[model samples]
Target: MRCVVMFSIRMDMRVILFLTLFTGLCIADSKGNLALNGMAVQSSLGHPQGDAQHAVDGNRDSDYKKESCTITKTEFNPWWRVDLGNVYSVSNVTITNRGDCCKDRLRGAQIRIGNKLDNNGNNNELAATILTAPNGTQTFSFESVNGRYVNIFLPGNDEILTLCEVEVFAVIDTPSYICGPRNLALGATAVQSSILSGAGAQRAVDGNRNSLFSLGSCSHTNADRDPWWRVDLGEKYKVTRVSITNIGDGSAARINGAQIRIGNSLENNGNNNELAVTVVSIPLGETKTFQFQPIKGRYVNIVIPGRNEYLHMCEVEVFSD
Candidate 1:
């Protein structure tokens, strides 16, 4: 696939490339970044943070820290900017401006995306401008604006260009979306690895989501937007092991088949596609447990593709020696 980098600034005035690592979005700050001084706007602007506007009234530059994007500035006043890593096929950007209204710093914020150009009629123009009202949180999605960099012009009506969220996508001919939560660094092992501690003893607590934002398999059947279950081995866990317990879904759920997948199913790495270690054929019953020779892998994703009646699952406790 294509590589996608974020916030990569070029100092030597050379075009850089960004790459996507697996199904994760990683912004590696190796080459650093640059500022885009477009429009007649001031460099970077200030947005009303906790008390920047209040601090201005209180005469406190010490209390306010202004974050700005130099490359992308407003057509009017103090602007905001987003220094992307490399040029991408950007559709649009979603900006959640600060919400406090008492300060006159922010309410309506304007933003745009463009690239720096050399001589000649390169044009270098991407897409149309995106403007927003002085209030509310909205997601503005647009067409593919190809460029090496993007400028998120911040509005400095108040104090600083205060923004809450930022999201950019690589849009070309592909009809796909990027999945994330990027940090899936742990490998896997032969010994048993624990994804959670005492907080998630039987039921599913928090802190077990993979790169896809899907939580690892927990005993709860009513998990958020999840129908299947999975476990990342973290390393290669080789065990002719067995035993699974702490499961029940009342009568509203039932699932079958005890199959396992080694890696991420979204972007196939071709590592463990056909390597399903079938433990047992599970039926829709009160409980199902199995014990057998297990294949060692970086992941062990158990799935119930077909919902027989409802979502059925239990806490699986694997045994090894």
Candidate 2:
């Protein structure tokens, strides 16, 4: 009887130890509605009484008869959009239509997500379409798209674009590369292949996301083939993510197609290192976060390969574990 009790106690201890280790390894995917409130919104017109800020105020009281949004009387492809402050891997978008009337006004509304501001961001990539749901909330889900701007456009003449609430659900990631708790890219040495004007490479590592890599705040390459920027972390570490902030107000296109690479290699401008993520595009003044399974490296590089296009960087941050 004594031996059996001792064995039972030992087994319980083993089980507890196993459970604790498993819990430590599991990291929950932080989930929440990213577009809850306090996002910048804009609209084409302010007549019929509607302000763009009403769209993201988390109010679902969509009574068109009441004083809600500044509505315009039906025009050509009238659009409304919200700037989410940063680029996000969007999962879905929920729109609240006017419960009182004009729910059909949202028919054929194209939901676009991208960085392009041409045509009031209507020219960007289409993620989903707004279905007609009268006096109710409708959620449109896409296959995990990425963007900083979310626009709703009714592509027709004399169409009213009325929105009560536009809730965007995105995978919000902690900024591991910025000046915050999980920041690992702080105070690193940055260098670029060329410098344009007074913009040097160190501005990227200066921990300021406001500096534009375009005119006078970031590093730029002049007449250089495959302009590249790199950061040295001084010591070898296992990198987990890399985030880049693009210039605001329609300058994000400058960093499109840039490749992020990480490794200990210095040959060929560190282009031969482990490939991180190819930046398809980033929205204006938004940070695009790229994740990896923790690659070990001391050098990180962002290069616009095979193109003579100038390299621009407002900020570049690297995260390591």
Candidate 3:
């Protein structure tokens, strides 16, 4: 009987150890190349077959004739950029140089990352500079930098840029409050400035984060100056955070410069409440969470001031800590 009990205990320990190792391996394998989901563009096209999208099509074919590489026309400061849709803590970038010919074209190229659109993101933070062209593929590792744009700029007169593939890896930060209290905005009374077609204000708080507008799950407002959306939490409570999801189909930049306010007052349509934050940008089909010092309020408002543009929101979530 003693021997049987010891054997059972040992089996259980072995099973627990195996599960721990398996779970770690699965998490490590889940991080994939982010460049595959990005939108690629270049300064100018050189070869008829060298579309900018070719470099990120998940192919590393070195032969340019096979149409798996990108080429820019001979010009000063040629650049290629990929919009990653959402901001990420980029850890490393890998570049595959053309092996068939003219590998030297990639020399002196600079890799930059940031959210700024100035100069087509070429003026962002420099990650690395390619002094020597790689014979095949080269990986450049750096301290994690946060950005939504990744650009490759070649600085020289009469120089053409060619790349077979570009891969970006990000350091995914685990959420701390994944399981928390119930959302305060769910089933709450929501009102917007104006309705566009069948889209109403209540859809933003329906507990659905579907980003597609065609799915009838989003709220839309007509093009009006300073369009606003507000949700009443029944009574005032300390608000801890707000999460807003933007439309996925298009015009995701319409939410830029929007303001979040909280208070019980309906003055100026709750637009005069305590300011929570100013949204700079939220990538398409993505949710951005803003956490600030707890503010007490029953009405939470999101207004895009100083603008005459449509307002669309796929989801809006409010939480109290």
Best by TM-score: 3
The TM-scores of all predictions, comma-separated, are 0.30, 0.45, 0.49
lDDT of 3 by residue, 1-321 (tens): 000101011343532211122101011112346677356878899988988889888888899989999999999899998866446677789999999999999999999998776666888999999998999999999877787679999998999999999988766433320112446787689999999988999999875566888877799999999999999999878897999999989799999999999999999999999999999999998999999999999999999999898889998988777
Whichever of 1 and 2 has more lDDT, that candidate is 2
Global local distance difference test of model 2: 0.68
Error of 3 at 214 (Å): 30
What ordering of candidates by TM-score runs from best to worst? 3, 2, 1
- For model 2, give the RMSD to the true fold: 13.4
* Candidate 3 TM-score, true structure as reference: 0.49
Q: For residues 1-321, write the lDDT of model 1, one tens digit per residue.
A: 233555433468845555565333343333221111111222433332431112112121222233221122233444433434234556765443434332224444444555542111123353443443424335567766655434344334433444444444455235442323222212122211122222222232111111111222334334323244444544444433433332322332233344544543423322233344554444332234454555454444554443332233434433232
Q: List the residue pairs that clash in candidate 3.
A: none
Q: In model 2, how large is the Cα lDDT of residue 233?
A: 82
lDDT of 3 at 142: 88
Tens digit of lDDT per residue, candidate 2, span 151-212?
88788887777888777776423332111123445556888898878777887765456544
Instruction: Output the lDDT of residue 106, model 2.
Output: 82
